[model samples]
Target: MTNFPNPDENHASARAGWEHIFRGGDIPPRYRSLAEPNPQVVEWADTLPAGGLLLDVGCGVGRHVVYLGGRGFRIAGIDISPTGIRMSQEISAQRQIPFEGHVSPMTALPWPAITFDGALSTSAIHHQRRADLVQALAEVWRVLKPGAVFIADFPSTDTLDYQDMRTRVAAGQLTEVEPNTFVDESTSPDPMEDLFLPHHYCDAADLRDLLRHFEIVRLQADLRPVTTAQGSGKVGKWVVWARRPMTT
Candidate 1:
């Protein structure tokens, strides 16, 4: 755990670094997006019926936007960090993708309720405090249209990777240098990561409670094999797929 108490406002640089490191291979870039979306999210999306507005919440570099846009889907992305927004904009300009990348907190979406046809957020939610996370989910529920599907990825405290982190912290090899932030990967020689970000770990039960409003379609606890700096292990992250009820 970080020595500093969790900060109210997470640093934008951390999120920006997450984006850069992801491209260079650490955790997937989109993980900071509000959920640990399963890696094959795009495959599942390809199978689903097309022709819907796709909302990428907490979108960092706008990878989702570019991917969906390439498939001819109307996509929009939103994030809290100015650095993230700039990175996304630069890419959007280069690609000439029709996307609106905005610097906005996911908790307060600028769009109207029941506006989107479907949405997906990659690993962006861990940054929020529990209370705020609940409210954010509630807001997302409100904005989703009936029959709209929402998918998000989140980290689990139960993972071996997390356990390793705790062990390191307990041993004093790593220390929380700042609130809601830790300094392990930061000290490493790789420029991809300067330090690890503070993540709010959620168990399966925690997720079920947080997203009670939506009818869950699928939930993965140990999403895939545990991936770390060394190599892959047994279990790592998880993803949740759900839908707002057609009626409510």
Candidate 2:
């Protein structure tokens, strides 16, 4: 059997990042977006049969989970952060919403094959290295029933922030160990310990190649507003909605 890294081991940085942001409480207003679900997800959900099961991969704080659950869909959410899962559970309970929350990496989901009718991964998958990102996408594909739809948003290489990062790499401020991969360091006011995490940026062509197995429904350029930490202007992302073919 292949040994998958436990959340505390290989995924420590991701878990720590989210735990620090959430701090075991209500999700910050900027991150809490239950009132407005992703438009693509909303459109796909409308077409699902009654009582469809939807999986929210990298579901931080259960924002989408709660919203979809309240809409009568059976919801299941998974995230690498224990704190995130806890917060999601607490909020769901407080809101009287029913859903399953699991603390696990997207690369290795703790579920059987073809378990969900739909899946949504927003602003999440890009956190991993390319290998892990591929594994996560394959896992997502594996868990969805044939003809099911999946929507995801990933950072694009065309973003201004990415260009700036490249310039910094040239100046040796940050390191790029692999193509389109960066070893991110905290640029905080005070000195901080390094997480040694790998962040990957993808272009539209890369995504098309990676997801060649699925029929592409729509792929559009999305601009994500960044906080001061991420620098000025909006970074780019590719939001894709695709469906698995009914037959292999």
Candidate 3:
């Protein structure tokens, strides 16, 4: 088994980085552009039972919560960053949409078992080492109802950042604390890019092993163009739609 940073250490670094980003006055345009609901999320959400209770894990700023809540789905969200949760609440309030938000890490959700009909996460979850990722997935599983759908995206090994990290690790310039996991140390002008957070990239086999408990509905690679202070490029991710088994 690969050794990883202590869970508390990891969570503390992540929380501080994210809180700083959220508390800072306007987020980067790259993130601001994501205000719209992801098309893939919209498609899957449409198939869920009407007005189903949903949980948005790592729902920074509550974009999905507000959007889905407006569509009549009862939605709650959780994030490790308190500032992010505050911003989410403020956004929901300004829109007059009811949103249940909490400050919590994914590895230990504050909800009860079988509390959510479905769950979704985006641009999150991959920020942990493998062990924490597993714990977080188990928490999601524990809180979801049987047959509940889950939609999430993970950074792919093909991403430029991952490739660069691999090269640096090989050159002994950086450490791969765990397989395909590296602490980002970019010096880009974008605060989001310079947060020095851990990022784990996964391949198909990795995803399969990570999601073995769920019945996968769809798994595919998605590449989307993005512009950042560093430059413009495509971001690669593996998007998955999975369902919990009705029977244990």
- The TM-score-based order of candidates, best leading, equals 3, 2, 1
| Candidate numbers, best lDDT first, in rank order | 3, 2, 1
Worst 10 residues of 3 by lDDT: 186-195
Tens digits of per-residue lDDT for model 1, 29-65: 4333423334656755775567677788877766677
Taking the tens digit of each residue's C-alpha lDDT, what string does model 3 give over 88-170?
88888887878889999999999999999999998888878899999999999899999999999998986666767777777
lDDT of 2 by residue, 1-248 (tens): 96554544548777776666556333344444456777767777788878899999989878788878888999899998787788789888988878799999898899999999999998677777677788888998899999999999877787886787698789877778567877656454112322245567788888898788888888888887665765666777788998888987
Better of 2 and 3 by lDDT: 3
> Candidate 2: which stretches are off by over 4 Å?
1-9, 24-29, 32-35, 186-197, 223-235
Query: Where is model 2 poorest over a 10-residue stretch in terms of lDDT?
Result: 188-197
Residue-level error in angstroms, candidate 2, position 148: 0.4
Worst 10 residues of 1 by lDDT: 29-38
Who wins the TM-score comparison?
A: 3
